[model samples]
Target: MIGLLATVPALIAGIRALRDRVLEVAASGATVVAGVGLLAVVLLVIVPSFEILPKSARDAERYEQQQRLDELDDIDAGFGPGSAEEAGQEMQEYVDDALQLLEVAPRTMRTTTWSKSGTTAAGNTCRAFHERIRLGDQVDRSSSAERLRTAWKAESDHTSFFERNGVLELSVHPAAATISWIRADNQLIVESDCIPYAAP
Candidate 1:
């Protein structure tokens, strides 16, 4: 989506040049071919950059998850296993910081102030949510973590996280302006309306 949006100006320029007949037919054809090729290359380059964005999100999520794991380890180290109270306390702390760790709403998030619809929805609320995970760890269906894990796994066109039973449910499209359920929360929380584009 970002790739396509970024390419709009170049696409427009190419079209304008062709319309103006700035070059002979043969030259224009070559330019068209080159433009198409450049588009392909740009898409390829942009695809990898998208990976960087999500991977960074994943990394932060992992780190936060690990921090919780470490806290659990420390609690268990002192109190032995089955320390639900301490674990829950640690989990609460984990929940508090999970969203930040995921960096779901990075300070650099791009927002379009101009409304395409010419009117913005009133009383809209947006917030970012994240669920944490460890490296090589597949989502465990039995745990609440599955809520976010499944969403991330099922990422595709028109999918977004909605909340149900204090957990996130992935669906074709979510109503909220922006919704992100990272592995840390395992629940749906409102995300930034500032995001006009589709989720990564």
Candidate 2:
């Protein structure tokens, strides 16, 4: 459209130059109008198609991620309250299964504990088991982060998980699981806990 519009002055100049030759003037004017009209029609069709393409691609990718997360959720739903060692084992298995499903390897996988002084959803002083997985150099950080965000959003529509200050959090029910993710440079760090404190 901009290109077509830019040619208007040139078209007017050509028309002015051929004003004495009525036939030529009419032909030139008609040609200019027809060209611009064609371009407008093409832009109308092409521009909207390009606009919708990226959104459709993102939606399809999100659907695939959601399906994978649903499978993971099915596995997670079976877990019951247990000792720290048992919860750690279950969280490890969850991470392993997720890695397998995602076809990505972690640079480092370790266990840690998150402690809080306040009472939790479980009616106890805060103590949670965490399994941290760090993506290796082999992974594409941006793409992985997008996929993880999509999966987390699909699992639960909670808006807090999408906040962009720094950390992203995911909480699962029944099992009291919580997952926190932070992206650093070219790596994505994921912390998962089967035994999580209540939201505070």
Candidate 3:
């Protein structure tokens, strides 16, 4: 009977050891499954970002380009010469500077003119002279506008004053500048000093 009792204790210890080993294996297997699941979740999130990265980069590039264009538009509005002759001279000077900046000669440069009738506070007749400077395909209008704006900002102190018929207008004391983007021709139309011509 004493020998039987000793054997029973050994049997209990052996059973306990087996139970502990089984529990350890189950815990290890659960941990492995959970780790694999976490890895899968991470991949699911990461893979889409990789696919979207290029598109996000493209969007950022486009936004920057648009910002540059808008800034150029604002800058274009600030240039104006006091008279028709001065307007012509100033336009040529601007074109020359723009060509230097762009490193390209315009295929063609042309000007058009018209007269608008206006009434003054007094009974005198007033005429507003409008001039449009058109540059040809050799000059990229958008780039030229940007360069011209930079040059104008450096040379003059002015700010955006108004908008009329989709054209942006700016004033510098006795002179005014009108800037418009011609989408169909991919050109820029700059009307300078479109105010009543006053004789000195």
Candidate 4:
């Protein structure tokens, strides 16, 4: 009977060890399953809902919209009624006033022909006059050139005589309340072209 009691205790110890090992295995399996589930949540649900998703496509659409708006603004800026014609009329008046000065250039400084061309914008005008002064029944070139210079001095507020590359240059700017010019052999005068005509 003593031997029987000893065997019964060993059998109880073996059953308890087997039960502890089964419990440990079950806990480890549960931990692994929990970790895998958490990883799945992060990858499949959380990542797809992130705000940064689709950011590139949104930025591209915004860029395209801005480009379209800029093009429309450019097209609308040039569209208007009579804007072109009004500019033309104002420019012509400015040109006509400037031409009057050429008509009145010293009567002795002969001009073979007048070729005037110019453009006006923003209430300003630019003119280019091509003039030719030919000797008129005068044998002495110096005396003839001097006579013309004297006449201009009498009528102008500024007079200057100089030579460049052995070519004589006499420039005069008469006191015109409207336009101003520098004249010599040929002339390039720059001043406001739209000012009201004032007799020099």
In model 4, where do residues sit more than 4 Å from their true spots? 1-111, 120-125, 136-138, 142-157, 175-200
Worst 10 residues of 4 by lDDT: 190-199
Candidate 1 residue lDDT tens string, 1-200: 55565555566666677778776575566557657866786777766887899999999888866655554454345532132232223333333343343433434332222222111122122122222332122333245354355544566665554554544544333222333343443333332222111112
Q: What C-alpha lDDT does candidate 3 achieve relative to the native structure?
A: 0.51
Cα RMSD (angstroms) for every candidate in the order listed: 24.1, 17.7, 21.8, 23.4
Which runs of model 2 end up more than 4 angstroms from their true locations?
A: 1-80, 106-126, 156-162, 185-200
**How far does residue 49 in candidate 3 sit from its true spot (Å)?**
84
Show pairs that collide, candidate 2.
none
lDDT of 2 by residue, 40-124 (tens): 7567755787879889999988886666555445445655444334545544544554466456744443334443234333333
lDDT of each: 0.43, 0.53, 0.51, 0.39
Per-residue lDDT, model 4, residue 34, is 51
For residues 1-200, what per-residue lDDT tens digits would candidate 4 score against the true structure?
A: 34334444544444555567756555555545555555566676568757555787798778866665554443245422122233233333333333343343445444343323343332222333333443233224454334444443454345455544524433432311121223333332222222211122
Q: Write model 3 residue lDDT over 12-111, tens digit each, in one string.
A: 5545555677565555555455555545555665567687988999998888666655543433554344344455454554445544665654446566
Worst lDDT 10-window in candidate 3:
166-175
Instruction: Sort every candidate by TM-score, greatest first.
Output: 2, 3, 1, 4
Cα distance off (Å), candidate 2, residue 1:
87
